[model samples]
Target: MTKSAAPSTEYPGLFSPHQEPLPGALDGELLYSWCARFHRLSGNSKASTTSQMLFGHATTGLRHDFPGQLGYFGAATGGHLGTLQEIVQARTQFALHALFLDESTRRATESVFQGNDRSQLSRTLGLSRSGQVSLTPLKACPACIGEDRGTVLTGWWRMDHQWPSMYACLKHRCLLNVMANQGRAHWLQEWYLPVELREDQWAEHTEMGQSQVERLIHIARWTEALLHQRDIYFDATLLRHVYLYQAKARGWMTWDGALRFATLRAAFADSHRGLEALPGWEFIKEVGSVNGGFLGLLLRKHPGRRHPLKHVLLMAFLYEEPLDFYAQYENSKLILETEGPAALDRRLTDMQSRLIEMVESEGKSANASCLELGIPTTQGLRLLTRKNVAVHRRPRILTDALKAELEALLRAGTERDEIARRLKLRKAYVKDYLATQPELRNAWEQAAKVQLAARYRAHFLRVLEDNPDVPIKRIRRIGGNGFEWLYRNDREWLAENLPGIWRRPET
Candidate 1:
């Protein structure tokens, strides 16, 4: 509604008191987040109206947050805000900026990062729109919005959702809902509010395959990782090179180095089985053809920049990590292969890498690594004979001792939560571990009976013992309930334990 507001006549002349940006807001922030904060602090409504006085021209969209235009926001805010490099490193999704190979894109990005001249551009690097791929709806998580407002006092858009393969919130883990379907440029027409998202009207869940929720959790985490760290960056060309090389190693390529689509299809079908219904996943069918949908086009020299999520998924399927992919990509040309020494050397190198991966990468200890790798033993001496890898031999003595003590306690009728506390272990872990032990399992099965019988019997015995003069009838009356169960189930024990009970029970 505020879109038509003209700064020349309708609005205040200039932003007074040039406000400061939020504190500790470096890296991993969205452009829209700062803009919303900007308008709020400036005491204005529509940025389209207010920004004219600041940036010299009212602008919308990418002008607000991309690295090139960040200086304007800093200049208007009248504070010692960090440079555009810091802004891109911290705010805009510039970590993944290396994925675009177009030298023009690289140059434009460099222009912004260098903070040279703050010039506007027609296209954003790695930002997909109106080619093979369309822009995804702007995403907002209701839970995240509430969190940002309650803690930080604002609910701005996130760069995480803008990346490919991102469908859920990193914080809340619920699927993110999209904003208005029209141009996002309209978002700045008025003050943006968290309530504007209105997630109550959105879909409950996205289309997911079996165990996809768990899979998505890992993917979402990696997406954020990709956003923050500069450790992984490869354009489409290098990615294709990596994919084909890995595929070749796995026997998914022909003698002529062309992809054996049949092998790839079967393999992809097995791994990404239920995921075929996803947007890009649908393109897998075209692998054999020249124009192999998104997946096929990815292998081609220029497929017009597939989303980062696509690369992430492909990497997830093939490589241990981006580092591994990068290693192979860097090695393909240098490493000579044959059926002899070179091949054996590469094979050993690969095995050594795998060994390191089992221990360090997977964060598994020696025994665990040996067990997982199907090695005979985790002892360093034995492992040295097989492969040169250090196994973090976690001492099992403490764990064994804890288990033994917990089992003994469980068998003695201690409650699970109490046992966990006394042992400084988790209640769920105690329960699960207890279930694994024969003694504890048997004890758990009898816990109810033991609990009920012990409660009644202990009180009965205690009362009788404390007052030696007290009679069984008096104790039964004091016991209140469960006297019938004792009278019914343990008639013989009751007689033997309390001989006096037999003498006076007729009453």
Candidate 2:
């Protein structure tokens, strides 16, 4: 039988507030690209119509780096794109700047994006204060566009190409093409894709020395990696320590934190002097003369201002890659915390000896030893487990009735903290107890998934009911978390309940 389509009446009316038919994100696709695709597919006549449907404003999608109203977008699409956290980490440039922001500022950025502050995000990230507004045009890779033509309708904007100082395409190892003569509003306010650009609008690529080209490419690759990495975070103090560690190793600074500024400055300037010709790269020419410059500001005891592009340039100059620098930063942290590697080794030895003496020589129980040492029982037990020493003690009694009750609670989807509170038990103790009961753990896990699936299913249906203008093709897109969860854990139910594309109800 031929497949039936959703009814014409069920189609979302023109300029519907609900944004449906949003595409699944392509690899490394920018949030801007995702929205642009929505505008094209929705057949909306004006850019503001798509923006209003997706972001509740005409200009929200215009901001590339810190796209506000993310919470609304997540809710509007019923979260099929991703949760707010997923959207922020995977689609936005937040991580690129997050490496340099303090913890509080980072948290604030999260709040702004995930909530309805509607404030200018650049100011919050200190971009305005640092005079770091991005003036460069949108960038694209010729090779990427060629490859994209085979799969997608148009080449989407990439997250990595939007970096302010990125001049090379990391994946293609070639110079990126700029959208020549197109004002910011032309691209940001319109649904212009890479494939839509006319031949004359394409700018000629600038020539650079091979060494300069390599340096720019190195910085571009580093920026790309930073954009995708979710786990790395560095603040002022940690960044300073890591920079000093490298400086000390290279004899560019004294062991006591004093830098030979003249020696370092000359070398840094020379390392990047050839890059001055590249558009937006003129900053390198004044590296030696810019007041206090980046070297002094970055390495100072307290840095007042930070620009992410400069940090990328400096980090690229210092380390082979971001992950390698992270490893060195970890070592620097250890040295800072323990005074030195020798001291760190001695401290570890002492800790091991104390754990041994408390558990073995002193004849103390694991709980007792850990309590006396002011450490967690889990830690103490781990040490004893490695030594093949059983922790002998009076076990906290788990009666049959209590065990049944605990299992029931777990299966009921009670949160761990709430369960602990009602049962008059410590949260960690309950956690450890759960770890020992695999059968019960498995049952609880299954129950949790079932409960979550039911919840998401209800939410997904409710969203559809509230936004009847949404088309059936768009229905799956708006299911967000509910759609994602049900799709993964209960595919049969999802397939069964998902409305027929051609079966929309009459109004």
User: Which prediction has the highest TM-score against the true structure?
Assistant: 2
| lDDT, model 1 | 0.54
Candidate 1: tens digits of C-alpha lDDT, residues 468-501: 6555545444422334446656666677887775
Q: Alpha-carbon error at 84 in model 1, in Å?
A: 2.0
- After superposition, which runs of candidate 2 have C-alpha atoms over 4 Å from their true positions? 1-20, 114-120, 184-187, 227-229, 254-257, 274-282, 290-292, 321-324, 339-507
What digit string (tens of lDDT, one per residue) describes model 2 on residues 32-148? 888888778888788887776666567776656667777666656666677776788777777777777767877778777854443357677776755555545667999988998
Q: How accurate is candidate 2 locally (lDDT)?
A: 0.68
- For candidate 1, the TM-score is 0.52
Global lDDT scores for all candidate models: 0.54, 0.68
After superposition, the stretches of candidate 1 with alpha carbons farther than 4 Å from their true spots are 1-13, 16-27, 61-68, 99-107, 112-135, 170-174, 183-188, 191-196, 200-205, 228-235, 262-290, 301-309, 333-507
